[model samples]
Target: MELITEGIKKAFILIFTGDREIFEIMLLTIRVSGISVIISMILGIPAGLIAGLNNFKGKKFVISIINTGMGLPPVAAGLFVSLILWRSGPLGFLNIIYTPAAMIIAQILIASPIIAGVTLAAVQQINPKLKYQAMSLGANRWQVLWILIREAKLPTLAAIMAGFGGVISEVGAVMMVGGNIKGQTRVLTTATVQMVRMGNFDIAIALVIILLFLTFAVNLVLTLIQQKENITWAQRFWR
Candidate 1:
């Protein structure tokens, strides 16, 4: 109880006073996670949508692959990335290890599968007949696709939030890839680990509080959108 009170007081002071290091670390965390979210959206959302909407050979296999990827261990991802970026490795020439770029790469790897899996689940729940109906109604491929995506907005937003949460809380992958370098690749999760090692409990707790707040905000927005739509499982997900 005493520790919690002290930590809260310190957190308020640090935030109110605009502690430079805290601000820097927080901004860097946002940058890494935001970029990762964008990358995940690009790689995962579209693929998930396609997988969900289309029927093809090996489609289930592909979805299974994504589902498996969602549970990938961050430490393993970091190790694999490290190996690939080593001097004699195939991607070594890019020289991305132990840097912010590496952190971004790690985060993208962590986030993409979650985004894809969630989106795929949402997509799969939509009615197959909707696609046929849309096509029969003179909706061109582009138009039909747009309608389906727009209808899926609420679930899609949930998937995006899930992806964001998965990446922001990850520590092992980023730490391994970035080496947790100070003033360079330090992010909230990794910074918290470092702070703990240094006995800076107050700042670590503060960061945790902010992280929790962010997760809550993201999930709240997603739920709010879903509620506003007032549609059934796939009804809002497919036009």
Candidate 2:
């Protein structure tokens, strides 16, 4: 209990005093996690939209695969990504096995499936009559699909934000792929681990505090989005 109290006090000081180490870790965490979410959105949303609207022989199987991947173990994702970047691996020529790029790749693998699965679920929740209503007016297939996507915006945003949350707080995959190099790949989670191991409790706790704040901010923003007041796009989505 004493150790816990001391750690919390030191953590508060580091944050209040604006420690450089804590700032750096916070910045890197935001950068990598933000980019990872963007990458997942670019790939997952379209695929999920297509899966949601189209009827293909293997479509169910493909969606099932994505749903399964949504829960993929982070360490396994780390190992698979690490191998691809290893010196003797197929992508070894890039020589980026233990860099931010590697960490981004691992995060993309972990988050993309989640985004896709959630997007698919959201799309599925929409009434079939909505699509039928659009098509009845002589709208083409693309038009109907676009209309559905617009309507499901809120849930889709929630899915993406959820993926972002997961990636930002992730420790295992980033550490394995980024190598947690100082001033280069040392993100919040990795930095926290190193600080604790080295008995630098102040910095570790500070990083954790920053992480909590950022996560809280993200959730608060998304929660506000839940009420589609000024979010007219989401309003259109809900209908």
Candidate 3:
């Protein structure tokens, strides 16, 4: 109880005082996760759309791999990324280890599968007849896809939220790839770990509080946007 109170007080102090380091860490967290999520959307959305819309040979196998990747262990992802970026590794010539770029790469790997899987599920849930109907109505391939996608927009937003949530809360892969370098790649999650390891319990709690608040703030905005078009029973009070 005492620790909680002290930590809350400290968190207020840090936030109100505009602590540069804390703010920087928070911003970096947002930047890395945001960029990674965008990249994931770019890469995953197309793959998901194709997988969901088409029934080709080995499609089930591809979907199974995507589903499996959705639950890929963070530590395993970290190790895999580390190996690929290691000094003597094949891609080491790019030399982006222990940096924000590396963290974004790890995060993209972590987030893309979740995005892709969710997107695939969303698109698949649409009526197959809708595609044929649109085509019969003289809609081109692109137009048909657009209409189908718009129908699944609600769940598509959910996929985006899920992807963002996954990467923002992730710690292991980012830490492994970023090395948590202060003023460079130190994010909220890694900073919390570092604080705990250094026995700064109060500071650690403060960081945790900040992280929770940050996550809440970002998701709250997303939630608002998501529910904007379709108010749910639970959202009645908010409306």
Best by TM-score: 3
Per-residue CA lDDT of candidate 2, range 23-131, in tens? 7878888889989989999888887888886778999899999988899999999999999999899999999987889999999999999898889999989886888
lDDT of 3 by residue, 1-239 (tens): 97778877887888889889888998999899999999998888777888999989999999999999899988788889999999899889889999898899898888899989998999999998988998999889887877777777778778888889899889999999999999998998999999889977766877787888877887798778776874353355484
Which residue window of length 10 is worst by lDDT in model 2? Answer: 228-237
User: Which ranges in model 2 have alpha carbons more than 4 Å from their true place?
Assistant: 135-143, 233-239
lDDT scores for all predictions? 0.85, 0.87, 0.87
lDDT of 1 at 39: 93
Q: Which stretches of candidate 1 lie over 4 Å from their true place?
A: 230-239
**lDDT by residue for model 1 (1-239), tens:** 97778988998888779889888988898888989999999998888888889989999899899999888888888888888887688899998888888888888888899998888888777787888888999889787776677667778888899899889999999999898888998888988999889988899888887778777876897788777754565466587
Ranking by TM-score: 3, 2, 1
Total backbone collisions for each predicted model: 1, 1, 0
TM-score of each: 0.90, 0.90, 0.91
TM-score for candidate 3, residues paired by index: 0.91
Worst 10 residues of 1 by lDDT: 228-237
The local distance difference test score of model 1 is 0.85
